[model samples]
Target: MSAFPIDYAAVFQALPGGVLLLTPQLVIADANEALLWRAGRERHELIGRPLFDVFPDNPDDPDASGMRNLRASLERVVATGVRDSMALQRYDVEAPGRPGTFEERYWSPVNTPVLDADGRVRLIVHRVEEVTEIVRAGAGDHPVDRVRMEAELYTRAQDLQEVNERLRLAQVREREVVLALQEAMLPAPVPVGHHRAAVRYRPAVGALNVCGDWYDLADLPGDRMAVAVGDVVGHGLAAACVMGQLRSALSAAARVADGPARALEVLGIYARSVDGAESTTAVQAVIDWSTHTLSYSSAGHPPPALLHPDGTVELLDGATDPPLGARPEHVDRPEAQVAFADDAVLVLYTDGLIERRLEDIDVGLARLAEALTRHRGADAETLADALLADLLPPGGATDDAALVIIRL
Candidate 1:
């Protein structure tokens, strides 16, 4: 024998508790039979109407807080896409026949969000259990005791709401502090002689708009400039502090070292001592305008791109090595140099610019090269923006990205 298919619509109507389907705007879309019976209202009166309009607060009661609490819970579900369980609430509904009379009601409500394919809240499932009879059961035998119990419940609900508000404020303050620290750590790029250069730093999206990515540009002695991009291994305030220290150490090393490889070697040594700095990746490059040479070294990072005037691209991956602090002992890092034409553009970036979830790194590199070749004719600033627009998603990347573009 074959089994029959399930009817979801019928099941929804047969649910034991009062259920309401609401839009993100709090409009009443549908109501189950149990809810219609409990609320003492017909389907036509409640459907196609705003939830608050249909069930407004009891105007005679100045202390009525049912509407406000329910609205807050629904709005929270829409904003964070998380479920909210409301405490016992005392609400009074209008009588079926009397126009101005109200009947006392108690409810326990839970609001849940239904997300679409793109992780956006599409609808809200508002389920409520009526407990009016339980609240009034001991009224005849012990009226004073019933009043005391109701008061205690109301006080507890108020305390919970206050605590939730405090937590939300604390989270906002923490995010603000992190953002300010990130801005202070990443300073503006220093002028690189007469070379046209542009740099862009974008943190990851969401509440914590900060991460462990950094970029540096400094003018070296003898008509040369050094540019570096690095990624620390974490997020939040701790990773940001570590990033600041490593970036400053590398900048100091680059000022005194003879070449890019020696500067990274110094950074690798420093990273081993700092907490939360292991497995960090960085690429340091120095461009000499006099000889038209680009010298670069990498510590487990993606290669830099060189776009020529003829729409040709070259990736500088010859000097790649393991990430910082990956080895048990110190090892000499490798360095490579390539000659570029005067009209060539040198691009150095963190891995977030091209990397995507579950995709091959080589595929991302190929995509970057293609984008660079197509925009070879643009200026340094324009080229930087174009590369980000082409490589990043419409909503932005999941990791931090630091980019440096220089016209040779």
Candidate 2:
């Protein structure tokens, strides 16, 4: 009785609950240090192991059935020395590479009847408590059920990235108002004089940000010269104000026409007298250049590809017209006449170069005539950037596109 100054390991390490001793053949003689640090193991891995081989119960995980109903209520108080109680439960412990952490348990059991002085019963006295902080304080009243599912997935990804950044800033302000209304509708790029020199342009991927396709090179007053490409129906700012009224009534009907099918019949009676709030669809051509002939027309669009000088390739597809505000019963065809001999190459485009709709427009027109006959040895801005990298098949084009190239 001289060593009975008992501090029994500070009363079983200040028993908040979770003490053990299950011997009567269930092994695990003693454990405390908070059940050996919640079984992450220590007291020599909890003395002789057993208690169902160190708390094994997860049989198909019903959250390990509250430690398997507290080992069936401590086997009914070790078969009779009776004393039991249980309450706090809830456990979802899955700690293997973490990520799931839930716990709350409260248990009880006590039984005693061992004595070599002439009595026998052995051991049992297990208790545990770790109410996982009262189930995480009742999960703070379910914070609006988890903030209404993270505010509807952050408001549908912040409204689809704000409508794709407002359609890429309205296609960069409609290509800066289609280059300030195509520089107030054709003012200079010279050649309205230099006999036999014309240029029409609208390549830079147009109002997809190139501004509604456009181009013209005139030298009218002497041995005429006129070339064109146009498209204006839908796309920002009413297609840049109907592409400056069909490029200023096509430079005032190619300076009072005499070719390109009477300057597209004077721009189709100037597009059936506009005012349906602007609309367009054009393609004109005229190059006499001292009898090196070539006249054209096509009030609807997309059919102009001629590269001769021995690499033979011509396509000004037969008759087509029905685009400008589409009515007044339109019709202005025939523009495939060619005699552009010496090193010729004329290509006008505006259905974004041989339209692309996943093959078959005759296979995107035989893949734009085999990529303009395999870049016919480039150089016209590398054959218009290798025919837009061989008709965009590597991610480019959800819709809008444009291009135009001509070299003679």
Candidate 3:
């Protein structure tokens, strides 16, 4: 029998504790029933509103710090993609139907991040439990009892701080492991005969953005060389492992296959069996220095740029097809060849180098072609650095990019 479908929305509303779903911008996307009831608000009153605007600190209380602390905790979660357990807080909620009147409230709150496959925080789960009665009960009539309670609260806060530190350390260690794996997979590019080649791989900037962008270079017999760059669909360890498998498979196929197109066909067949390898985009090219020709093929990736001696740029886009594992049946991939001048340069790269949010891809391709023309006289290594500086933002790229430059 098939399993029953679960209604996630209903389960969210039925949760025992008050919960708010917030975007990274702190806008309230949703609030569970318990939260709406506790705040004395309707669903429409809170949804689509900025969190702080809906529950601002009471203006009458000069010492109020609830909003400030909560904002800090939420921001930390967004930055680190880690959970934050806040200390017990004294937050006053405005009394419903009574303007300018506020009631003293205490809360135990925790903010957790909902991370994407790339390890970036997509949403925040703000869970809170009202503890007004508990705090009031602990407030004794005698000064000695009150002092003891305050001491206990202080200890609890210290414990939470220690836990937060441990979590931060663990996150740091995980990032190190991912970076190490990426470095192990992508080795430095070596020269092919007299042709100088330079490669660059930049992971997306963020805690969880270490992705599966990769480049491989292999020297073939008869003064020929093959280079390929690919991007896996997701990010983190799973994507990296898939990237390693695909890169190795393509590299091996390049040695035995007759052309770039055939190498990609073999890689595509292997990708179908690998988990998390669907819709992977890659471009492979074989440069024959004796013939001064570059044969290339694409699996739904950005075209490689061929810069002529006179600075005229040619985009090798004539032989493009759907990404790997995109189709159920096997089909022969197309191949194209272009004769190059002795001093010409060839560039192969992933889309992150040129793609921007809400912009046309042609615009980015045009920009790249112009940059290549402007710096056509530079050596391969210098040209690679110049292109990255020109194309990437100062803060860094939003997606992983792998670039290969070869002087023909």
| Local distance difference test values of all predictions, in order | 0.88, 0.60, 0.88
Residue pairs clashing in model 1 are none
List candidate 3 stretches off by more than 4 Å: 1-68, 74-89, 92-168
Residue-pair clashes per candidate, as listed? Answer: 0, 10, 0
Q: Give a tens-digit lDDT track for model 1, residues 264-302.
A: 999999998999999999999999988989999999999
Best by lDDT: 3
Error of 1 at 284 (Å): 1.2
* Candidate scoring better on lDDT of 2 and 3: 3
If scored against the real structure, what TM-score would every candidate get? 0.69, 0.28, 0.70
Candidate 3: the clashing residue pairs are none
Local accuracy of candidate 2 as per-residue lDDT tens digits, 1-408: 656688877887677656787776667888787766664556775578787655555455553455555565566445433455554444344443343433333222333323221112357767666655554555456878545643443354345445645855776676777667666665454545544333334334323534456666666765666778777665555565766776778767777866665676667677666653245677788767688877787777767778876565778766556555555654544555667875577777676555553444666667777777777766566777777777754433433445555566
In model 2, what is the error at residue 219, expressed in angstroms? Answer: 13
lDDT by residue (302-383, candidate 3, tens digit) is 9999999999999999999999999999999999999998889999999889987667899899999999999999998999
